[model samples]
Target: MTDERETVEYDSPTGGWGSLRGMVQTALRERPSAGAFETLRRQNKAGGFMCTSCAWGKPKHPHAFEFCENGAKATLWELTRYRCTPEFFAKHSVTELRGWSDHDLEHEGRLTHPMRYDAATDHYLPCEWEEAFAAIGTELKAIDPKSAIFYASGRASLETSYLYALFARLYGHNNLPDSSNMCHETTSVALTELIGSSVGTCVLGDFEHCDAIFFFGQNTGTNSPRFLHPLQKAVERGCKVVTFNPIREKGLIEFISPQNPAQMITGKGTEISCQYLQVRAGGDIAAIMGLCKFVFAEDERRGGTLIDRAFIADHCVGYEEFRAKADATTWDRIEQESGLSRADIEEAGRVYVAAERVIGVYGMGLTQHVHGFENIAMLINLLLMGGHIGREGAGICPVRGHSNVQGQRTVGISEKPELVPLDKLAEQFGFEPPRDTGTTTVDVCEGILDNTVQAFIGLGGNFLRAVPDQGRIEPAWERMRLTVQIATKLNRNHLFNGKTAYLLPCLGRSEEDMQAGGPQTVTIEDSFSHIHGSLGHRTPASEHLKSELAIVAGMAMATLPPNPKVHWKKWTGDYSLVRDLIAETYHEQFHDMNARMFEPGGFYRGNSARERVWKTKTGKAQFTAPEMLAATNVADADGRYRLVTVRSNDQFNTTIYGYSDRLRGIEGTRDVVLMNPQDIKRAGLSAGQRVTLVGDAGDDHVRRIGGLEIIPFDLPDGTIVGYYPELNPLIALHHHDQASKTPASKAVPVRIEA
Candidate 1:
């Protein structure tokens, strides 16, 4: 097939007229109601709905137009005029809709009614809310509680998440898994073990006081575009910015703030990173260790002045062992594993050493690996060596992709008992909550394959599309006895209906939710642990739609036996009661949630690390030192490229807004792969040649994808990049972080085929 492509070097800086054009184009494409413009004006404001995109923190005093271009796209996508009513489903059968692309399916617009699948007609027919709830309750009651899986997406509010978790536990099961299991589970595990906190220590204001910022594996351009303003401010103040990744992401290089009228008029952008180091995929452990090695050597040269000797002596433990491991690691080994030379690593290290206050930032690129846990641990070790954390503008920031992923985890959407506090939960909810561990995202897939998990309930996510090993999960998903999805729009996952399947529509975050107490507000936590309330001003898309809180409560009311202790109906009627209960459950952080949310920027849940009060067993910050220098295996000595999954500029999670990846200079296509120019020649392939990618998991799965055109670019010799969810099929379900169970999507072994 001939290549139909337009791949060129992206020259312009990120967030200039390009962003302005995107915002206007998306608004026109969605053709939202007149109220949509007013909705955009209030985004991220004190009394407005939170941007349903990345989990970046909102500023204490937000500007007039506080939302980013991508955030506007998300709002417009939800506010589209098109509706997927029962009439639309009648026209297209499930068998036929399965052939539709993901973007096409969702672009059809918001779901208007609760519908159930009809196997005879292969169509979804509208059903009453009462009937749908009764059917789900009957199926759930027939199965063992352990055999049902309750999954949630980060789009849910904290109140809804708290209710979802309580319902699962009350049903005598603890299998509650959400989006966090796939994204920042490694950060939660590593931080909890070492520093006694699972969230970042730096607030949005920290950017003002920092001397340097080091970025690893995070692409702020598409993932968290709102953060570019802070980076731009840091650069303007002469704060050193360094980036380490396999690809030179455009956002890290330069940015033009749309808020800056002068810069926007001039079309001039501020340069972001002072140094860009292209590290190999899954090589963060080695790269971080090299920084530690350099710091240790510099301290030796300065007569022990470079390292924070006093802070280390007072606040940290296990330093001697970590230093010894760094001393023993050879420069040649570090260079080989990191895909960076000694001089480059040292040059980056010099910036870290010179800055008294620094921030280390990263995203899924570092966490979605086989040794993801160790990668986070090694980063902590590097910060501990310099005593960089717990100070002004100095800490570790794990940039979350979803809007409230961190908030969901903060409010008991976890499979682990330790994270959720099962014992206290049992006391409050009046049930014997299960003490045993529950299934994670990976475990849910395994259970479905084995037929041990017979039922599935999803809250606002396309589970089947976002997971790995789609070939294996898709077939197993059909064998389930029952599946219920509470969502706003129709996606590919909704098409794979089980024997008894129901698609229940919920209110979007941009819509006003009216309860008995009047229009209610829901709260979400940002990446920095700032808890704030989100209030929507627009009208509902359909009169039949219900809020997520009501749907979760309705499911619980129908499924569980009558119990006076739990006020399911009343709690849903007045959401403030839900917040009160949550406050009772977690008194320390959420004592007065309702009142505090009215304050500007809400409240900050102070980090223990920032207070210098460690919650570890030893009562101090701990340094993790593993015997081996590299956490995970690198690329094969033979010729094989490490596969890295990425997202397009116009996408959020699995939802595709458009086909254009503006920063990469690709348009109107997703079926393409970016490869190193040298690697393409070695594989006997030319640029723009249609080729296939075969997975090398050392198994008999025959995991391969075809019809992908190759685009040559300047990157590491043995690395290739492809869009996520599309390339998820190549990653084995079992290939995940052993400690956190996050899929190692960053460094899958693969080969190119013609």
Candidate 2:
């Protein structure tokens, strides 16, 4: 720990020697130094692996050092020398291991072989790959296909996810829920409805041309460091970057590129945000509404078409409806709900209007709310009003964290079967797939709780930690008839064993996957719609480890009765076959997928929104009057604070890199809650005082997470922040975006337990 007790620093920029040192320390600790360096150099480059940590698009012209700190961290972690062999598991019982932290569990090292939980021994014993697959197959085939859940984590490749999705469909189920359900599901839900696609309209080149970027509820620095490169360039080019979040993030403020040798030596950084707004948690809709009101009022004042009347008339719908809603939204209400003054919002509005090319960027902050879908709609509404869609430098950018969360959906990893191209699937696979909608993340969790869902097959991701209300979900998962996690590293999820649970070890993105057709390359879709190939730069962590693609294929072959139509062996042997299947399915977007994947930076999956062509029912980019659900609920409740779950700087999704959040000046702890000093005093508590957070959303289900030490933080008066997974218990499982079924993890009504 730093000598400075409870240290808090401000105005520090992200990246620098610190990031370099972090990368080195992690590498030395987890993997061989030489191998780690080679892997880092190879990240997101030609003939190297793409980072699975974030889906931030790559630069067209690469820098000397392409990868960022977290990307390096992810690389080192994936290529770790530490292995959890059978001997390791034999020493620790599930109960004993359950007491360990999520960090300690993963840090114990990667699973080296397929292991099945032996109830008699209370330990995971090594099992033969084929035997393990046979057991999993038996469980899947025995259970009702509708009751079985195939949970993808978005860490898998497009080919792997496609095969998994197909396997599930062939088995007659559409329960293809993924990590996107927790994060960018709201983005998908909004984009699909508004623009006829679920991906961002902008490409990486757009950043070079965009005049301004309005950052909504995302900490791009920590979550996506590669973004800082372009963001810094934008700042240097006099482009505006505005930010809105409860707590200010260093990445949004300034950045010193770790890759830049000059900056690394000089310790200088670049400023990013021209304007920063400390929006209250769940206030995105109000903030956008405020921005819209200014734009509308300005156009009215000008009377000579300041609101892009031509674009409005030709390219969009619901203008008058959205405009009236914007007008009806009072400045007082906006100020109160958004925690931003009318003048400040108008200043942002001015920036928005002045910029000819504007790009709106957002992440879970805008989408991880009860009104998350509405928040996205409002953001899109802001873009549509400015005629920002389908332009070279303008569009909505949904910054997905997982490498291929977007690709997973593109390859048919969706619960909504309506989105699936059933006619193509039937033509290609000869299976009349079930048209019925299956379980989503929410439904799967509900099913687990109610004991309706009996079996679970997780492709990747720490499912239990990532989900809300883990306290309830974990035990429910333990009660399942069968659970299989095809994973690289051990997580908290692995500890919660079902009656028959199996941990099937798989290859990481950095590891080589050699099948009958020799080494394989997988495809990942970036935040932009660019589809690229990633070739592993390192050898396999263990010979026993299988590709997620092969594992899914093995299970599919074993589970399904022998059929000529489903050529599982062929797909397993040659991944190109899987790519061929994708190309056959979505011929337009993935045409010549395997061939195009070999292109320098892969190919862009065609998004209709990018061409100003909306595939909507109304045949235009439809403006939406999103309900002010968050604003209506922003009324101050006595003894309550809007507690928002956030990630520490050292974390990636549920994977805690370490205990420190360097940017936040928080260290050596995960038990503290970030609160405004005024709110602490209002609650009759002092800084460093401990309190129990009692969830107060409603009903008989009272959630209490105790022993949280309050640390005074810079944020809105009514908003409090806590690092997630620990605070996951405070969020209700059912509390999610109604349209997207995404957990409302950002804001929850909570009070000090009295």
Name the candidate that leads on TM-score: 1
TM-score of each: 0.98, 0.97
For residue 104, give model 2's deviation from the true position in Å. 0.4
Cα lDDT tens digits for candidate 2, 1-754: 2221233544467988777777777776786524667777778876678888899887656787888888888888888888889999999998889999889999978889899999887899999999988898888878899998999997899999899999999998999999999888888888899888788888888888999999998988789888999888888998999999888889988788876778777777887898899999888888889999898888888885667789989999998998878777788888878889999999999999889999999988988888887898998899988799998999999899898998999989999988989988998877798999988798999999999999989999888888877878887788889999989999989888788789999999887789999888899988888888998857787888989988998898888877777888888888898899899899989998887885656588878989988998899998999767372243467887888888887788889878878888887899988887677667777777778998887758868988887788887888989988889888888788888888888878788862
Error of 1 at 302 (Å): 1.0
Which residue segments of model 2 deviate by more than 4 Å? 1-7, 629-635
Clashes of 1: 0
The model with the greatest lDDT is: 1
List pairs with backbone clashes in candidate 2: none
Model 1, span 151-193: residue lDDT tens: 9988899999999999998897879889988888888888888
Determine which window of 10 residues in candidate 2 has minimal summed lDDT. Answer: 1-10
Q: What is the lDDT of residue 743 in candidate 1?
A: 82
lDDT agreement with native, every candidate = 0.88, 0.85
